[model samples]
Target chain A: MASQAAIGFTRGAPSLDIIDTEGLVEATRLAFAEDPAGTTAYGTAVGYAPLRKWIAEQHGVPVEQVLVTNGSMQADAFLFEQLVSPGDAVIVEAPTYDRTLLNLRQRGAEVHPIALHEDGIDVDAVQALLESGVRPKLAHIIPNFQNPAGYTLSAPKRARLLALASQYGFTLFEDDPYFSIRFEGEQLPTMLSQDTSGSVVYASSFSKTVCPGIRVGYLVGPAEVIAGIAKIATTTYISPNMVSQSIVNQFCRSGRLDKSIDTVRAALRQRKDALVAALERELPKAEYTAPQGGYFMWVRLPGVSIDALADAAAEHGVAFVKGADFLLEGGDDSVRLAYSGLSAEEIDEGVTRLAAAVRSLDA
Target chain B: MASQAAIGFTRGAPSLDIIDTEGLVEATRLAFAEDPAGTTAYGTAVGYAPLRKWIAEQHGVPVEQVLVTNGSMQADAFLFEQLVSPGDAVIVEAPTYDRTLLNLRQRGAEVHPIALHEDGIDVDAVQALLESGVRPKLAHIIPNFQNPAGYTLSAPKRARLLALASQYGFTLFEDDPYFSIRFEGEQLPTMLSQDTSGSVVYASSFSKTVCPGIRVGYLVGPAEVIAGIAKIATTTYISPNMVSQSIVNQFCRSGRLDKSIDTVRAALRQRKDALVAALERELPKAEYTAPQGGYFMWVRLPGVSIDALADAAAEHGVAFVKGADFLLEGGDDSVRLAYSGLSAEEIDEGVTRLAAAVRSLDA
Candidate 1:
C-alpha cells in the first residue's frame, strides 16, 4: 500500500494553473512602492482601511459593518469567543466543516446538529428545535456550495433562516466562502444582504478566489459586533498581515480579482464536470450531490462501508475523505471528493481508481 | 481640548526610513517566482516549514520546539488559551504591555503584578509572591527592552527566573520582540536556552526586524507545549499568512534580514540619543533611565500629575503615553516617550515641547 502512493482527491484547494502569479507580484510591488511604511507598520485591528473600504463598497455596506481578518476562520474564532458561553446551545450542520465543529466544541458550546438536504440545511428541523425550547446562541451555516456536503442553501431556506434568527434572537453566522464560484446557477442573495434586523454575521474568504496563502477574509455584521470582534482581534493578534492585505487591496482595486475569479471558475467547472462524468460512468450506484460552484462533491456509496472503501481506495492509489470525518453522527456510507486541485484528466483517472476500490470493498 | 492638536510620541513603531522597501519587494517577487503554488496554497497550522526551520536554526533549537504564529500576540493568545484556566493565578510585570495584561484579564486570570526595575523585573517580589503560597500557572516576562519601560532583564535574573519557573512548576513566557534591536548591550541568552525542565516558552517577533506587515512570529518551548499551541492555532486560524511567511523566508535566506536589523539599530540609536539629550537640556527635573536600546524611555515627573501633563502636552503639540495606561496600579506621575518612529530632530523638538507642557502644568 505504501509503495503504490495515493493520488489525493481530498485537498480543497484552487487549481494552480488559474493562479495569477504575475498579477500578484505586480500588486505586491505596487503596494511596497506606494506605501512601504504603512504597509510594514502596525495596522488597525479591524484591517487595512483601503481594503476594508473596498470590501464595503463591493458589498454595498458601510465600512464599519465589515472587519477584515486573517481569514474567515479567524472571524469564526473571534465570533465564537465573543458569543459562546459554556453549555450554550449552538446549531451546526450535520455534515459540517469539521474544523468549525471542533472550534465550537472547544469553546464548550453545546452543539446541536441539523440535517442538511439537497437544497440546503433542513430549516424545518431548525425551526422544530427552536420551538422545542432550545435557545441557541448562534446558528452557523455554510450557505453556498457548503463544504463536504456541497449543497447551497435554497433562497426560501435562507429567508426562513434569517426570519428565525430575528424572531428567536440567535445570531446567524453565514459562512459563504464559495458563493462567487457559481458555474451554472443564478446567484442567490446573501443572507446578510437580506438581513435587516442585525442578526446575520456574514463571513467570506478570498482563499477560494484570490489565494489562500495571502490569508485574507472579511466579516460583515452589526457595527457593535464588529467592534467587539475587533477588540478580541487586538488581543488575539495585533492585526492581520498588512503586506498581504495591501497587495490584495491593489489587486482588487486594479480589477484583476474578477478576472482571476473567472479563470478559477472556468478551470474548476471543467474539473468538476470531468469528476462528475467519471463517477457516473465508473460507480453507477454511487449517490452524490452535483455542486454548482464549490470544490467538493459529496458521494454516498450505499451498502458499502466508507472505512473499507477509503482503505481500498488508498491501496488503489486514489484517496478521498471519509464522510465520517465531517459528521458528528452517522456517515459510514459516504465520502467527499475534492476536485479543485486536480486537473480534469486527474479527476477522471482518480474516479476510475476509486471505482476499482469500491469493487474491492464489495469483494 | 479638541482644538489643541497633538504630536504623537506614543507610537511604539520603527522609523519609516529604516524599513527596507526595495529588499522586501524583491523578496516578495522572488517568492512568487519561485513557489507560486506552495505560496498560495493551504499551509500547515504551525507555519511554513522553511520559515519555521530557519527560525529554529537561528535560535539553536529543534524545529519541533517552534510554533510559528500570525504574530507574537497570537502566540500570547494561544498560550493563554492553553494554560490559563479561569481564575488561575498568573504573574505579570507591574507596567507590562497593556494588551497582554488586558488579554490575561479577559481570560479571567487572577493577575499578580511584579514590580519592574531598571535592570529587569523585580525577581525578589516574584519570589516573595510564590513563597506566600500563590501558585501562578505562568509568569509572563519581557526579557529585552520591556515595552513602555525599555528595560532588559539581567542575565543573572534571567537564570533566576527560569529556576523559579522550574522550582514552582510554572511556565515562564519570555516575550522578547526587541532583543535583536539592542544597540549597546552585552546580549543575554534567552530563558528558553537556559531551561532544562521544559518550563520556558520564549516568543519573539520578526515585526521589529523584518516588517510587521508580514505578521510573522514564533514560539520556542517544550515540544509538547508547542504542539498544543499549534492545535489551538489550527482552530483559531488554519495557518499564518503563507505569502508573507514565504517572502520573509526569502528575505532571511538571502541574508538581507541582518542588514535590515543593522539599519533599524542605527536609526533608533540616533533617535534615542537625541531624545535623551533633549530631555537633559529642556527638562532638568525629569528623571529617566537612558536605555541602551529599544523604542521607549520611561520618565517620572515629580509633583506633576500625568493626566494634567498629558493635557498640557497636547496643548503644546507634544503627546506621549500616560504611564497609567501601562500599569495595573499607580503611574500617575509617569509617562512613556517612544522615540523609534521620529527622526532625531523630531525627537529633540518633541521633547522640548513636552518640557513646555510640564512647565504649563506647574504654572
Candidate 2:
C-alpha cells in the first residue's frame, strides 16, 4: 500500500541499534575528564597528538605520516587537491564513489575509468592504460568493501597495483574505510603496508566503526606528503574537531571501538543474509556477486531500466541508489542496495517492494 | 635565564578558565540523551535540521539559507571555490586573516587588497577600485572586531559596502566569527542583516563563543547560493560533526552559552586593560589602536623590524605573531597580540618581557 512506510536501502550509514551509545557516552566523559586542553582547545591541524599516536601505533607508521581529518572524505579531497592538479590524468574504478569522481572532475583531473571484477579493480587495465602513456597522477582505489560494488581487492591485485603505481610514478590512493568491517574472509594486507616504494597513501574512517556523527577519519602516507596535506588542512580549517577525536581516541583505547565493531558486524551479517535471500526469492532474474562483508549489494536486473524501476520502486515504498549514479556512464539496469542501515525485517520488506515494482514495470 | 616558560600571544584561543566545562558536560549528556538520531547519524551536508533552524531563527532567515560546516573556514573556501575562478578579481582587507588570503590565492583569484582605518575597511578605496573598472566578483569583510587589526566597521561603511556590492554585482562575504564576543559599546547590526539586496553571504563560528574543539560553524545566504554550497559540501564531505552541533544546540538552548560568553567577555576585558596599561608603561614608542573588545590588538613599533623583534621576543619568553604574516607585503614593523588566551597578570608579564625584547633588539 502507498501508506506503507518506505524501507530505504540508500545510505550506507549504520543503524542506531548497532551503535554503542553507552560506550560513546562513557568515552566522552573520559575524554573530557582526562585531557581538557586536548579536548577543548584549538588543536593544531596535525590533529590531537594522542589520537594520531593511536592511529600510528595501529598502522605501524611514524606519527608524522598520519593526518587526522574531519572525515575520510575530507582526507580524500585533500589528497586529490594535493596530487591531481588541473588536467592531470587519474584512474578510478568504473563504478567508484560518485563524490570522489565529482571532486576529481572539479579539479580538472582527466578521469580514466578502469573496470572492476568481484575480486576488485582491474589492475591489468590500469597497467594497460599506464603502458599506453596515460601517466596518471593518481589511482583512487576503494581497496576493501568498495562502495557501490562491495568488492574487496585481492592480495595479488593489491601487490600488482602497488608495483604499477611505483613504476608509473602515480600515487595509489588506498581509500579503505570499510577495511575493518569484513564479517567473513581474511583481511588482505593494505597496499600501503605492501608498498616498498612510497607510492600508496592510505585513508580510513571511524565513521563506520565508531559512528558517523563523530566525524573522525585519517590519512597515512609518507611524511612529506602528509606534511603537505596538513599545510592545506591548516589553511582550510585551522584544525579538525578535537573534541570528537578525543572521544574517538578514548573509544579506541577503552576497547569499546572493537566491541562496537563486533556488534555492527553481527547486525550487518543478518541484514546481508536477509537481503540475499529476499532477492533470490523475489527477483529471480536479478544478478549480483554476494558480498563477503561491507555495506552494499550491487545488482542488475536482466531487462529492467533502473530509472523506470526507481519511480515504480518509490511508489512501492522502497528506496535504493541507482548504480549509474556511481559510474561516469553505463549501469542503466543496475542498483546498489545498502544493507548496513537496515534490519533483516526491513531488508526483506524493501526487497519485496522492489520486486513488486519490477513486476509492475513489466506489466 | 633561557629556562623561563613562554607567554604566547600567537593564538587567539580563549583561556580554558572561561569555558563552561560543567555546562558543556551537561550539554553533551542532554544532546546524547534527547536526540540520539540527530546527534549520531550521518546528518545531511545541509546539516542537522534542528541546528539549521536555530541558526536561521537567530539570523532571521529561512532554514534553506543555512549550511552548517565543519568550521567557518570551510565555508570561506567553498564560497571562494564557487565564486572566484582562476584569475577572477576579488577584494579583501590588506592585513586581513592570513589563512583567508592563502585560500583565495590557492584558488588563483587576483586579490585586490583594500586598506583599513580605525572605523573599518577603507570603503572609499574599494569604491575607487570598482569605479576604476576592477570589477571584483567578491569582497571578504570581517565587519566586527576584524582579525589581526581588532577594528570594528562603522555602520555607515557597512551600508556603503552593501550598496557597493549590489551596484557592482559583487557578493559581500561577511566573515564575522567575533560578532557576539563584543564586550563594549552597543552591538552593531551584521552586514547580512542590514543588506536590502541578496548580496551578502555571512559566516560565524561557535569556536569563539562555545569552544574551538566543537568545530561547528555555518553560512547564511540566499536560498539558491546556500543550496549550491550545500551541494558542494555533500560531495566534499557528506556532513559535518553532528555530535558537536547537537551539544552546541543544547548549550545555546539552556542559556549556558550566554553565561560562557559573559565569562569570556569579563576575562577579555581585564586582559585588554592590562595589555593597554602595560604597553603605555613599558614601551611608549610602540603605537597601537586600543581595541574596545575582541581578542587581538594590532601594534606597530616605529623602527623595529618584526623579524628581529620576534627572535628577541622568543628568547625573552614572550611570543607574538609578526603582523607581516597577515599581509601580502609590507608590514615589517607590526605585530598582533592576542590577549584573550591569557590572564591579566599574564598579559602584564608578557608585555614586560616584550619590552625587554625590544631593548635587546636595540642593543
Candidate 3:
C-alpha cells in the first residue's frame, strides 16, 4: 500500500506557541525542587487543593463545587455515566461537538438535536422539543464558540436555555474549553452564569489554554452532581495526576495562566484571521461563520456533496471534517476547519486547497 | 470552634502520582519542537503511537494487544462497563482492591470473592465458585503481587487459576501494577503470559513503579475486549491526553524507565525492611507475610480489634488502612500498612506508634 497520508484540519488541540513549554518546565522543576516527596506521594481526591482553589477563584465557583478530572472529556463522560442510562434521552444542538455526540450514542442514549442557527442554538426549537414530551435527562451544549459550528450562544439565548432546562427538568451540560480564547465579539455570559435553578454542569480545561498533555480539566456543578461525577471518577482514574496538577496550580498561582492565555489568544486570532480571509477570498460563494473566540469555522458548501469535497481535498493532501461527523443525523454537506494549530501561511494554503476541492466537487 | 477533623482520609490519594510533571514538561517541549502543530491538537484514539509501542514492549505483549488508559483503575472500570451489567456475577479475590470492589458494586453486579491464602488466591475456592453455578461474567484478579492481600499466586496455583478460567466462561482481569517491584523471591510468571483462553484482560500501571500523578496506564487483551473498553474510554475521555503519553514514551525509550524503577525499588525495599523489622520487634504477636514485591504489607494483628487499632494509631498520629476496607468477609482483625511512601525512619516511627496503639487497645 502507498504511504498513508496523515494531514487534517479536524483537531481541537491548542497551538504549541500558546502552550508555554518553558513555563511548564520551570514550574515542574520548581515543584520538584520545592517538594520532591510531595510530588511523588499521594494527593487529594477532589484535586490538589491549590489547583482547586485557583480554579474555583478563576471560574467564580466554590471549591466544593469543582472536581478536577483527567480531562474535560472525562468530566463529560463521568457526568453522563451518572445521569444517563442506556436508552436515556439526551438533547443536543445540531452539528455539536462530535465526541460528546459519540459519547451519548455509545451510552445508548437517544439523542435529540435542536437546530443551531447562525447566532446559536435555536431556543424556541429546544422549548418545542421539551414540550413534546421528550423530557431529556440532559442537554449537551458548547455555548462558547461551539465545535464544528463555531457559533456562540447569544446572552438572551443563554438565559432562555437555562430557563427551558428548569421548566423541562433536564440537566444542562455546558462544555466551554474555548471560553477564554475569543478572537472577537463581546463575551457572552455562560449558561452556568445564567443558571437560576442549578441545572447546569460547567466544564472547562487547561488543555485548550495551556497544554492538553497535562490532562487536567475540571467540572463544576451542584454539590450532589459533583459528588456523583466524583463517584464515577473514583472508579475510573481515581484522580487527575497530582504532579501535573500541583505544577499547574503553581503556574496559575504564579500568574502564568493570564500571560499564557494572552499569548495564545493573539496567535490563535492571527491564524483564525488567515483562515477566514482565505475562505472569503478563495471560496467566496461558500457560507461560513467567523467565530468571535475559539479555534474553528463551520463552512456550508451549498450544493456541493461533502463526501466528494472531502475526497477531493484528500487528493490535494488536505483533510478536514465533514458536517456529517458532527451531526446527530448524518449526510449534511458542511465542513469544519480548525485554524488554531496551523500558522497563518499554512492556514491560507490549506483553505486554498479546500476551496479547490469544494469547487471541483459536483453539486 | 476547634477545627472538625476531616471526616475521612479525605486528602490521601495514591493515584495522583501517574502524571509525571518533569516528564510532561519535557514531553510538552519536545512535542512543540518536533511537531509544534500536533501538541495542541486532538490526537488519535489509539493513543500516542510511541507510548503504545513502549507499553507493548514493556509488557512483552504485542502493540495490537495493548491500549493505553488514564490509569489501571480506569482500565478496570471501562472493562466492567463494557462487559457486565446489573445482576451480573463477577469473581474477585476476597479482600481485593477497594476500587475494584466499588466499581463492581456500583454496576450492581453480584460480587463473589474467592478467599485468598498466603500462596495466593485459593485455587480450590475459585474452582469451587466456578463450578457452583455463579456463571460469572468476569473474574477480576491481581495475579502478580495483589493489592491489600500482598499475595502472588504460587507457580502451581498459577496453572490451576488459568485452568479454572479456561473451564469457566468468565473473562479474567489481571491487574498487576506491583509485579515488577518484588523486593524478594523470584519473580513469578504473569497470568497474562500463562493465559490460553484469550479470556484475560491484563492491566498494569506506572503508578506503583514511577508515580501516580499523570494517570497513565495500559491494558492488554483480546482485540474485541480492548475495542469495547476503547468505546467506553472514548465516551469517557474522548482520548487520553497525548502530552504525558509522549513524555512517558520518550522517558521509557531513553532507558530511564529501568533506572527510575531501580531507584524506586531500592527505596521501597528499604521501607519494606523497616516495617518488617518493626513488626518483628514490636507487633510480634501479629501474623503477617513478607511481600516479594510492591508497597503494601498485609498484617493480621493478634488479639486487637482492627477498629480499636486504627483508632489508636490515628490518635497517635500514625495512619494505616483498616482491614475491613479490603474484605468481602472475615478480615475484621486484619490491617494493611503501606510503608513505601514513608522513609525508613518514618516507617520505624509509624510502626512503633502502631504497635503502641495495639498494646494500648489491649490495656
RMSD of each: 1.4, 1.4, 3.6
Off by over 4 Å in 1: B1-5
Query: Can you give the DockQ of every candidate in the order shown?
Result: 0.84, 0.79, 0.47
**What is the DockQ of the complex in model 1?**
0.84
Better of 1 and 3 by DockQ: 1
Model 3, span B257-341: residue lDDT tens: 6766777667767867888898899878889888877767788876678877777767776777888888877788888777665
Q: Please give, for residues A264-314, the per-residue lDDT of candidate 3 as tens digits.
A: 888888988888788889988888778888888888877788887777888
Cα deviation of B343, candidate 1, in Å: 0.8
After TM-score superposition, the amount by which residue B59's alpha carbon in candidate 3 deviates from its true location, in angstroms, is 2.9
Off by over 4 Å in 2: none
lDDT of each: 0.90, 0.90, 0.77
Model 3 docking tier (incorrect/acceptable/medium/high) = acceptable
Q: Give lDDT: candidate 3, residue A190.
A: 78
**Range of the 10 consecutive residues with the lowest summed lDDT in candidate 2 chain A:** A122-131
lDDT of 1 by residue, B183-229 (tens): 98788888877889999999998889988878898899989999988
> Which candidate ranks first by DockQ, i.e. highest?
1
Worst 10 residues of 3 chain A by lDDT: A1-10
Q: Total clashes, candidate 2?
A: 0
TM-score of chain B of each: 0.98, 0.99, 0.91
Candidate 3 residue runs with Cα over 4 Å from true position: A1-7, A15-18, A35-38, B1-41
DockQ-wise, the better of 1 and 2 is 1
Kindly list the per-residue Cα lDDT of model 2 for residues A1-363, writing each as its tens digit.
Answer: 789889999998998898887788888898888998889998989888999999999999899999999989999999987888999999999899888889999889999999989999987788789888889988999988889898888988988888888887889999999988898888788988878899999999999899999888999999999999999999889999998999999999999999998998888888889999999899898999888788988998978999999999999999999999999999999999999998899999899999999999979
